[model samples]
Target chain A: MGNPAFDILSILPFAVACSFGMLILLLEVFQRQTASRSYLAGIAVVGFLLTAFVSGSFLPTGTARATFGGMAWIDGYTQIFTSLFCLAGALTAMIAPRYLQEHGADRGEFYALLLFSVAGMIMMVAAADLVVFFVALEIMSIAVYALAAYTRRSKLSSEAGFKYFVLGAFASAILLYGIALVYGATGTTNLAAIGQAFGGDVARGATGDAAAMSTLAQNAIVAAARGADVSVAAVIGNTGAGAVPLAILGATLILIAFSFKIAAVPFHMWAPDAYTGAPTPVVGFMAAAVKAAGVAALFRVVSVALFSDSFRGGEYGWVQIFFALALLSMVVGNLVALVQGNIKRMLAYSSVAHAGYMLVAFTAVGFRGGDISMGSGLVFYLFAYTIATIGAFGVLSWLGSRGMPCDNFEDLDGVGYRYPWIGLAMSIFMLSAAGIPPAAGFIGKFLVFKSAVAASAAGGPGSGLLIFLVVTGILVSVAGVYYYLRVIVHLYMKKATREVPEMPYGAARWAIVICAVLTLALGVLPGKLVNSSEQAVGQMAGRADGVYQQSAEAPLPTPGGIRLIR
Target chain B: MAETIFFIVFALGALGFSAAVLIAKNPINSAVMLVCSFFCLAGIYVMLSATFMAVIQILVYAGAIMVLFIFVLMLLNIRDDEIEAPRLSIHQGIAILAGTGIFFTIALSIAAWSGSSSRVAHDTMSDTFGTVEPIGDQLITSYVLPFEMAAILLLVGIVGAVVVAKKRF
Candidate 1:
């Protein structure tokens, strides 16, 4: 509260991206109508690089601090995800210009919207309050909706944009309603306050007879005596045991909304159509940065707000819900992907399967003492998945031209012989995505599944469920190998029946090479990223207490539940 | 007792108009029905002592937004025959059933919880509670981050509107 300037500085990465977005829009207005706007892509890449640079500076510090009146966290997890998003944005920008130019849709606003969306993403992962999270999510979704329809001349693109906007808006409404319910039950949108209300130890500390006073009523008395707002105190006191059901419903709604965002099964009907119809590079961004942001926010909210003992492992636990989603997304995604002829649609399903894999790690987080490694594994998997997906889509955009989109498997026939470098890069991406040996995806899967196995080995009540999830994940991933390898087969073994058009190797080639090298490097020497991810998750665990002190200011009267940082 | 009567009247009006909005076949009629629903909602808000919210609800939603919606409906210039006849498809039937089930579940839960001892009496609130000043103060102070972010959200919305609607760059 004393340092508003520091709060502004804490959001430097978001500000930098927003400024660049505005700069691009302004530049677009001044440019001649007939002139090429490809340089705008370069400017956007530069913007992303600066954003990454600013975020990266925070990585080594390993500090977790709440800023902006406790609305956002400047923490290792935030920095890591922000940097990852910037990388995704930079790669997408590099891959976009040539594709956009080719499709006669090369407008500077594409890069502007890309920057605006990335800015939103940077904030989304960093948001500590549900209000900030919702607004940032809208900023990201709105920009992406427009980006999906950037090629408005095409009916498919327009349809994709309209469908995504409608579904996404509906999901946002559900999320807002959930937030409202949680606020009604807890009387605050601050995540830490909600966590304090949900935590079990505070309920035990009340002086009144345990049977007479509800846990929420006890906490509300303690909180009110500690100088909480009267309105908040009143709402919390009134809800009593009823608050639990309301909050649970709210959390479930929020989880459903996030599942839609991450393209989990039962809510993933939009992914195939949107990915197939969107411009290629935009698809790469959606598959990479957008999914990463969704997963990041999901982890934050689940860990900070809903990780109470009662909430983590019971009949109504999120772990059980995530386990079902993971199983369904993996099985259904892999199975549906096998039947898809369009490469983009295939990858879209593959992305769903990858989300399932991430959820496998997410489910492990609920097991006793499994959070650090499982959380780190989730991060590493996202990094691996983001780069590999973007690279795969980059290769598709590279091989495409004005008339031929190069979306089908046949379009890739004998591409290995025609363009060896692009083919090799595509092979590496495909290999990584399939979780094959000597590739990043393999290491990511290994880390995640290994943690799940280790958690199972600990022999808890839900250990058997964790083992089942891991086994099911591994089996479904084996099914996933067929479609991923099919791309490589088309690249090398098959002969082209229809001649594939050759496009110039532009900045997209460089982006592909970068992704390929990073994929292999992470696979071979994952020590740095693995250690950093662990450090990030560790910071997250340590920072939960910091959030309480920052928001509440006065020390919480409850003795046992929270370790106040101050 | 008077407050209870007002609450009942506004609540029933809001729900009835909302259902009418859905049932109206003409696009213009539906738009007007929606406007009526908004006014009833604003009345409820005012009864809850949220004068600022009620005023803004009427101004932004009922007055301005409804006008724009009506303008668009007029511009589209659709005849009554152009509207699809209400048909109970299986999907629509299932959706309606699910909606009713959820509504009843929530209503029952609220009804059960209403008997709890800790209900906040309306007189407990401060005189300035729901006025604009306190809201503006909260918006600029603790909630400033989201307030600023909302501006960015609006900017993005505007940009998105132009990007999707513009025929040519």
Candidate 2:
């Protein structure tokens, strides 16, 4: 391995974000009590821009290198998601200052906590080991817990924070138990090493060469035959039968934990209250960056560590689990969202529905030979959802004032006539969320469904299921149109029943305009981003194969009874 | 034979104390029973040859945490009559049934696996295994990333505690 000092370069984005976080906290200490703290958001935005720049610099090379002794990976997948999270964080910072001030809860620690949370998201997406992933997840989660309760004067905010903390801690405990079980089964926490012990190379060879025993397995057996190792046999043999149940159970638990983070159905009981009670800008960050981080973690753990021929199909497969979750989330989220009068709560349920749509792409990834396109589709869809959802929440925060919070559908009456720019931005976001044409969400849905159809055409065991899921998603999204349009109807047609005071626009207006424009731009011309997303997934898959090849070439048994290449 | 006897004693003590911790009416008695449970768990850790873990379990949980818990209990000085005894509801019944089902399922699975060839035999463990030195080395070396990240987590936790608990900023 190279010098450990060089590994710091791989985490430069995270370091930059953390340093800015600390700087903001320090600045908060020296500032006069009455002095405006708005510059903290400016500093936080600049920090995010620098982080995005550092992450984007890695995009051209798309090099897949494991750093931090294989505890983290520097690759296109990590770089892309890191930049996306930076964008989301910057937008949230831009939207936050005025909203916080309006509520008389303006504090410098808000920006610091936001920066720290973004730093955690960066580390989490790049994490290659379970330990790194878990720690980074806590770093993200704890900061968010504090941010949710940032406006401590409100009992609703305090209650939201308490509920999120309790549930999140429970989820973390379950996740840790899963990691422990997986380590017990595979003898290592390193994802690549776990892949090796899970007989991924053997399963891959079985698919290619049609061999009863893969050549790699033969090589391992031959090495054992020469008395080089006995544990190699135990590793290969046990994975074939004995440890499979434990491994599957662990994988299932991990999936459940991530589902909680992503707010999938059955595990989404906390989303509505948490979303509605938290500060609007913070909700934007949570809906966009936090959920994207969860999806990124799922992509790594499920696609790299647990991906095997056996794990992809059959009764206990993760694919089936995701299918059930996707179906339930889409139906329940959309149906529940229809009746909600509170715009924030509606968006919360809609976000759950969006999670279902992403899980559709996720389920497609598990099918044989569907990884690349489906993976790209999932990435693109997340970007689309992030921008639109953040924009929606930004507008909500923009409309709200100290005593008069604009949360209900009725609050938007005559808004289109009153503030044309905000009304237009809201319309664009609503259309995108509803997946109307000429908006980013439409293109995102098209890409995901098209990829699913293409995968089905490629003819796999679950081809029929894929087509059925696509059809179901399309039909359910039609119901989503009514609620989305209702916002526009209220915006344009209804008269203001009360004297809604006009609020001055600030940095939040810029964030909304940017999100609206980007949504349209991406929808109209998606070729460049689609290509880059495809390339990123290709590089990710290449890294997985490279790890498998490395393990295949050297089956050397370490004292831990597993071969780990650091 | 001696190891098995110790194992049985420690496991049974842990289970009994845990049950007592749950069932005890007085908050002080429950906290004390929780300490006893922690001590028994530490004993089991010692039997598993995780001496460092055993020591920390006793030192941290029994010594520090239990002391805090007892202090809180005493400070509160809550009367027994003031606290309503929790009546078993449908939710509680369902929770109990599900918990028992899961416990038995896991216990049975472990029993089956222990008798099977798939169970990894850890007879070849190095003498340095579970010791403080190697774990400390690992914390600085291969696990340095997580170790550093945990510092950030704790920082966030401290900040979170202040943000949530502080009366005024």
* Top candidate when judged by lDDT against the true structure: 1
| Candidate 1, CAPRI quality class derived from DockQ | acceptable
* lDDT per residue (tens digit) for residues A17-64 in model 2: 988998998999999877788888899999999999987783445567
Candidate 1 per-residue C-alpha lDDT over A103-186 given as tens digits, one digit per residue, 9 for 90 to 100: 888888999899999999988888877888999999999999999998898888898888998999999999998888777656
User: Where is model 2 more than 4 Å wrong at Cα?
Assistant: A1-6, A58-60, A200-240, A369-372, A497-505, A541-566, B71-77, B118-123
Docking class of 2: acceptable
Give the RMSD in angstroms, all C-alphas superposed, for model 1: 3.9
TM-score of 1: 0.93
Q: Could you give candidate 2's per-residue lDDT for residues B1-169 as a string of tens digits? A: 9999999998999999999988899989999999999989998998776788999999999999989998988889899898888899999999999889867765654454344424444664456656787667667765778898888888888878887887875
Compute the lDDT for candidate 2: 0.79
Q: Please give, for residues B53-168, the per-residue lDDT of candidate 1 as tens digits.
A: 99999999999999999999999999877878778899999999999987886666555445533565676777776788767766776677889889888988999999899978
Worst 10 residues of 2 chain A by lDDT: A557-566
Off by over 4 Å in 1: A1-6, A58-60, A201-232, A369-372, A497-505, A541-566
Error of 1 at A300 (Å): 0.4
C-alpha TM-scores of all predictions: 0.93, 0.92
